[model samples]
Target: MSKRLYVGNLNFSTTHETLQTVFGEFGTVITCTMPTDRETGLPRGFAFVDYATSKEAEAAICSLDGKIIDGRPLRVIEHQERAGRDHFGPGGGGGGGRGGRDRF
Candidate 1:
């Protein structure tokens, strides 16, 4: 079965292709998604990588976790579905100001 992994602590300059190239060393990367900021349209410093197989995902976690790239250590782990209410609230959007109220 395919496995999904959460890749954290990514550098801002890291790109989707770069992630594919790096993770591709272990096995086929099914999909790589890097979320971007809604306002700035910039990388959110993390990505989700889906591998073709569990073995490949394990290999990537073992070999790439804690590996330094662009002066930042990579945090690789199995993706887990969030439970309960999202900490970001209803729309999963940012909570600004006090008590989840918008300051603007």
Candidate 2:
């Protein structure tokens, strides 16, 4: 079965098509995607690549991880499921607070 990997520290200029092309050297790329910001629509400096098989994914990671691309080293690893964090602070993560005060 195909396996997916998380590719971090990617150049902002990196594209899904480019990723597929680059990683294709290792094996068949099922899919490639670069996460982007919703507001600015900018790359999040990371991406995910799905390979045709786990062995291919491993080979890609071994060959591409820490490899230079766009002048930066790539970080490749098995993709992990995301778990929502408790972004809420003491009151909340919104940073709502009183006026500035010099409290000792």
Candidate 3:
């Protein structure tokens, strides 16, 4: 099955195409994405790379993790799906402050 990897500690200058080129050495890179700031539109210093197979992803993790690129060590690992929870805070609960329904 296809696998995704979280690539962290990327240089701000790193581009999606650069990630593809780097990771492509291991296997087919299905997709590469580097999120940018909503307002500044600058790289978020990380990326996500999708490989055609888990083996390829594993190979990438083993070979690329801790490797320096653009003067920053890369942190490559299998992407773990985050657990479903509240968007606000812990215990999936929120909005219990002075401005809430208890306000006089």
Candidate 4:
């Protein structure tokens, strides 16, 4: 099965092509994505890279974790899927608030 990795602490200027080139050295990259802020349309300083196999993914994690790219150390790890979390619907994660009340 394919493996997905979470790549964090990325430079704002990092691109998908750059990730493909760098990560491809270890193994075949099936897919790469760099998310952006919805409002500002700026790079979110993180990305997800999918490898064709878990072995390739582990190789990348061993070699590239903490490797500096664009002056920032990358945080590479196996991506874990959250269970039973519907983020697209209401009450997804809007918990823990004062509910318009103040502690005076």
What Cα-based lDDT does every candidate model obtain? 0.94, 0.89, 0.92, 0.94
Q: Residue 20 deviation, candidate 2, in Å?
A: 1.1
Model 3 spans > 4 angstroms off: 87-104
TM-score: the better of candidates 3 and 4: 3
lDDT of model 3 at residue 102? 64
Candidate 2 lDDT, tens digit per residue, 1-104?
A: 98999999988887777788889999989888888899999999999899999999999999999999988899999999876666663444575676778754
* Predicted structure 2, TM vs. truth: 0.78
Find the number of clashing residue pairs for candidate 1: 0
**Candidate 1 residue lDDT tens string, 1-104:** 99999999999998898899999999999999999999999999999999999999999999999999888999999999887786766776765657554745
Work out the TM-score per prediction.
0.80, 0.78, 0.83, 0.81
lDDT of 3 by residue, 1-104 (tens): 89999999999988787898999999999999999999999999999999999999999999999999989999999999998776776775555556767667
In candidate 1 the C-alpha lDDT for residue 47 amounts to 97
lDDT of 4 by residue, 1-104 (tens): 99999999999998888999999998999999999999999999999999999999999999999999999999999999877666686565765767465766
- The clash number for model 2 is 0
After superposition, which runs of candidate 1 have C-alpha atoms over 4 Å from their true positions?
A: 84-104
Model 2 lDDT, residue 40, Cα: 100
Q: Best candidate, TM-score-wise?
A: 3
lDDT, model 4: 0.94
Error of 2 at 37 (Å): 0.5
2 or 3: which has the higher TM-score?
Answer: 3
